[model samples]
Target: MWHGDRNGHGEGGGRGSAQGWCALALLHGKIEAHLERELQGAHGLSVREYSLLDVLSRQNSGEGGHLRMGEVAEAVVLSQSATTRLVTRLEDRGLLSRYLCATDRRGIYTDVTRAGLELLERARPTNDAALSEALDAAEGRPELASLVAVVRAL
Candidate 1:
């Protein structure tokens, strides 16, 4: 199991030491790295880039699919400036469109284009398969699956 070893020093080690957190972080990092490569090779998109697309795809504004620049950053776990850069790249590719907020002039929204939605749909199988493979590697242990459940809930 991930929390700690069978000896009870598992999750974080006895009394919740940093080792457990480190272990968790390590597992997360490894899986993310693997998924990053898988997504990139198959779809020409990084995990983070695809994540931005996924977030926009879920938003709605009829044909617009708009989200505030800041909201986009939060949903994608990026700084606003970084989100802007990514959004610009998507804009260049016709995968997304950005516009000023109608009611609030200062608020800029980014929307997923039809092409972006299509790409995200195509990439989902690769994303899911890689994630499943990563989790399946932990299948013999229930604790790891529990952790996955917790993450999915979040």
Candidate 2:
């Protein structure tokens, strides 16, 4: 099994190799922080916020990607309560709206508003650029480059 250094990576290190565990942890943080800064500075959205919006964007909810609260949480990998608070925050900004499910009044769903979509679209480039730069930085290392490519796809 790999063991990563404190920085969370060992170049050319295999998964769970002796040298590292969480081999990409540091790199992931670096890329995520860059994207976070870009989105926050330009659009006032955090990475989690953008990820939630992106998840909704891919949903087939006819009304601008409406999704049940649980569904949204699952899709974005956020806790139920966390997603609730996040939805509230976005709702407050008019970026998202929550409504009772028409057929199941007990079920509440959150939908992305035009504002949310617009912001997400704008954040896309920033997200891409951050990921691209990080990957490019590791391009010269064969193993790292391969890992970067895999992560970029993910």
Task: Give per-residue CA lDDT, model 1, range 1-154, as digits (tens).
Answer: 3666667675545755554565567568767888899999999998889999998888877655567788889998999999889989888999998888887899787778889989999999999999888766654455455566666677
Worst 10 residues of 1 by lDDT: 138-147
TM-score computed on alpha carbons, candidate 2: 0.77
lDDT of 2 by residue, 3-119 (tens): 666767665564457433344665567677877887888888898999998887777757645677888888888899999999899889998887788878998877789998998
What lDDT score belongs to each candidate, Candidate 1 first?
0.81, 0.78
List where candidate 1 sits over 4 angstroms from the true fold: 1-17, 62-65, 138-146, 152-154
lDDT of 1 at 58: 84
Which candidate has the top score in TM-score? Answer: 1
Clashes found in each candidate (C-alpha, N, C closer than 3 A): 6, 11
Per-prediction TM-score, please? 0.78, 0.77
Predictions: Cα RMSD each: 6.0, 5.7
